[model samples]
Target: MGRKHTPFTSLSRRKRRAKTLHIKNLIYRERDRLGGIFFDECDQVAALASGRWTWSDIIFLSQDPAIFWNAEIITANVAFADAVEDIAFNEAFSKLNAAETQQEMHLDFTPDVSSNGKRWLRKPALKYPQFDGLTFNDFIDKRALEIARDNPPAIYCGYRILPGYASGIGLQIVVEADRLNRAVIETAIADFRARGERNWISDVPARVCYSDKTICTPLKIKE
Candidate 1:
C-alpha cells in the first residue's frame, strides 16, 4: 500500500515562514517610518520658518501619503500632550471648592486631512469626547484606552506589493494584499497614472515595489 501523504508541502512551509518574517519586519519598519517622519517634519517645519525652504516645498513633501499619515499621528500626540497639561490645571482648580465656576475643556483630536493610509495613530478621539462631568485626566485616560485598542502593536502587511505612487491631490491609495492578480495590479497602476495625469500637470513618475512573491508583476503576469 502507498504511504500516506502529508497535507503540508515544503512550499507551503516556506511561504508560512516568509509571511512570519514579513510581519516581524513590518512591526519594526512601521515604527521607524513614524519616527523618521516626525523628525524629518520637525526639520522641515523649522526650515520653512527660517526661510530655508518655502511653503511650496513643505506642501510638496506633505503630498506623500507616508509623510502625511505620520504627521497626523505626531500632531495628535502633540495635541493630546498639550491637553493633558490644561486638564491637570483645570482639575486642580475644580478640586479647590472656593468657587463653582464651570470650566470647559475642548479637544479636537481629529486630523485636518485623511492620509488615505494606515498610520500609527488613526481616528484619535477622546474616550469621553463630550467630557460631560469627568476630570481632565479621566477623559484623557479614556481616550488613551481607546487609542490603545485602535492602534495596537501588530502591523498589517496585506498591501506591500503595490506601488508607492502619490499625487499632490488628495486622492491616494495605500493597501496591502496577500496575493494580487494581474487585473488588480494593472487596475491600480492605471488608476494611479490617471490621478497623476489629472492633477499633476507635469510628468511625474509613479513608483512600484513588489516586496512579496505572491504579488504578480505586469511582466511576470503576461509571461
Candidate 2:
C-alpha cells in the first residue's frame, strides 16, 4: 500500500512551510529596525550595487500605490501570514507615530535571488501614470475580473507552518465573481478534500478580499 500522508510530509505543504519560514526569518532579522516605515526612489541598479539595501528594507512598498506608477512594480504571491504582515505594519506605525512630521520614511533595500521566496514570481513590470480617480480596491476589483475572464476556474492552496511558532492554511477558489458564492466555495472545498488532499484544507475557506468592504470566505460573506 502507498504510504499514508500527513500534513507536514506533503510535498506542497512542506514547500509552503519553507516559504513561510523564510519570510518570517527575514522580518525577525529586521525586528529591531522595524519601528518605522521606509521608502526609496533612486537608481535601482546603483543602489543595489552599493550593498546598502536589502529586499526586507522596502517590503512595505507592496502596500503603496504611488510607487507603482513612479517606479517599477514587482508582485509576489508572498506566503502572507497575519503575524508577518502585522509586524511590518506595526514597525512602520511606530515610526510614523514618533515622527513630528507625518510622512513616509525613505530607505534603499535591494533584493537578489538569494532572498527570493517561492512567492516572488517575476513578470514584466507594469507602469501606470496614476490610478486616475479609482480607489485601490476598485483597481483590484477590475483586475480580478479581468483575471477571471482570462482563465478558467482553478483551486490553489496556501499555508504557513511556523514549526513551534504558528501555522495557518488557506484554500483559494478562483472562479467568476458571480460564481464565488459561499455555497460554491464550500462545494469546492468538499470536492478538494474528497480527492485525498483533505490534510491541506483549512477549516474555513480562505478569506479572499476583493475590496475593503467585500470579502468571500467559508465563515461568512462580508459586504
Candidate 3:
C-alpha cells in the first residue's frame, strides 16, 4: 500500500497524516510583496526584496500582466504515512480518485511518448537563472517557470512526486506569479498531471474521500 493520505489542511481525525508542500527559496519580485496572501507561505523568502524599490518595479511590471509570474519552486516529497496531505494531491487528487470516474484509480504518472512529460523529461534539479540585474526572487520567478515547462532540459522538482512511501519519483512545475495560490496552484497541478507521462511524475494510488475534519498537512508547498 502507499502512504496514508490526510487532507492538506490542519491535522484532522479523518486524515490521520498528510505531507505538506515545501519550497527551497521561493522568490517574489516586488509587486506589493505583501499582496500575495494567497500563497502557502513566505518563509523561504526574505523580506528585504520588498518595500520602496521592490514596489516600484512591481508597479512597472503590472502594466504588462503577461509576465507577472516570474518563477517559484516549491519542494515536495512522497511520504507513505502522510502523502495525501500535499496541496497538489488534494487539488486534482479529489478528481483523480473519483468514486464514479471512468478512468482507473491506480493511474500511472508516466504518459505515452507523445505526451508533454516525455517531451520535457529530465533528472531532479533546479534551474537557476543567469540574468545579471534580476534579483533572486526574479530568477525564481522567471527561470523556474521556464524550467517547469522544460523548454529544453527537464527538471524534477519535489512537487511532482506521488503520495506514497516509495522512491524514484518526483516532479517540478515552474510557473509565473509572484505568489502562487493553493487553490489555483492545485488546479494547475492537477491539469499538468492529467495529460502527461505516467512514469516520470509521482506515482501513488488514491481513492476519493471527503470529511468534515481538517487534514494534517502543512501550508507550504516546496522543499
Candidate 4:
C-alpha cells in the first residue's frame, strides 16, 4: 500500500517552501543592492582620480538638485542594505542561540577569499583620500578591505568532530563574509559537514562510533 499524505504534511511542506523562497528573495535583493553600490563607488573613485571633483566640492554640492537626487538613490540603496542585514543577522542569532549546548567548543578561523580566487590579506588601514592615489587594482583591494571592516567575519556555532578525535565535538566556526548574513552561517555548516565526511573515510575502525557531541571541523579551502 502507498503511504498516505496528511493535510498537515501538505501544509507543512508548503510553509517550508514559502520560507525558503523568502530567504532566497532576500539574498537576491541584497546582492543586487550591494552590486549597485559597488559600481557606484567604483565610478566615484574613478571620477575622483580624474580630478573631476574634490571631496570638499562634492560635499558642498550635496544640496544641488542633481547631486541631491543621486544622493537620494544611494541613500535608499543603503537603507535597503541595512534592512536586509538586520533581518539576516536576527535570524542567524536566533538559530545559533537555539543550538547552544553543554559540549566543549572549538574555534575555526579562516581568511576571506575573493571571487578572483585570491586571499584578501591586507588590513584596512587607509581612508578615502589615501585610496585616491591607488591604482585600479589597489582600489579594489581597498574596497575589499573596507568591506571586511564593515562586515567583520561571522562566527557560526555548531557541532563537529575535532581534528584527531573519533568522536563528535561542538565548534564555533569563524567564516569570512563579504557581508555578514545568514547565508554565511548556512555555508559554514554545509562545509563543516562535508569536511567531516571526508575525514571519516580515514578514521574508520573495527567499530564505527557515534556521539551526540560529534561535529565536523572545516578543512582549509585551498586558494
Residue-level lDDT of model 3, residues 93-179, one tens digit each, is 343324423243333244446785565443222222333455333443444344323432222322332333221123344333233
The top-ranked prediction according to TM-score is: 2
Model 2 off-target regions past 4 Å?
A: 1-165, 168-170, 175-182, 198-213, 216-223
In model 1, state the lDDT of residue 65: 25
Clashes of 2: 5
lDDT of 2: 0.31
- Residue range 158-181, candidate 1, lDDT tens digits: 111112223111222332322222
Selected candidate, larger TM-score, 2 vs 3:
2
Question: What's the distance in Å from true for residue 214, model 4?
Answer: 28
RMSD values for the candidates in order, in angstroms, are: 22.0, 22.5, 22.2, 25.6
lDDT of 2 by residue, 99-210 (tens): 3113224332334456574344433323222434443334444545444345322323422222221222322223222222223333433444455433243443333222
Backbone clashes in model 1, listed as residue pairs: 127-143, 158-176, 158-177, 159-175, 159-176, 159-177
- What TM-score number comes out for model 1? 0.19
Stretches of candidate 1 above 4 Å error? 1-57, 61-102, 106-134, 150-194, 197-223
Worst 10 residues of 1 by lDDT: 214-223
Checking candidate 2 for backbone clashes, the offending pairs are: 39-106, 39-107, 53-110, 54-109, 54-110
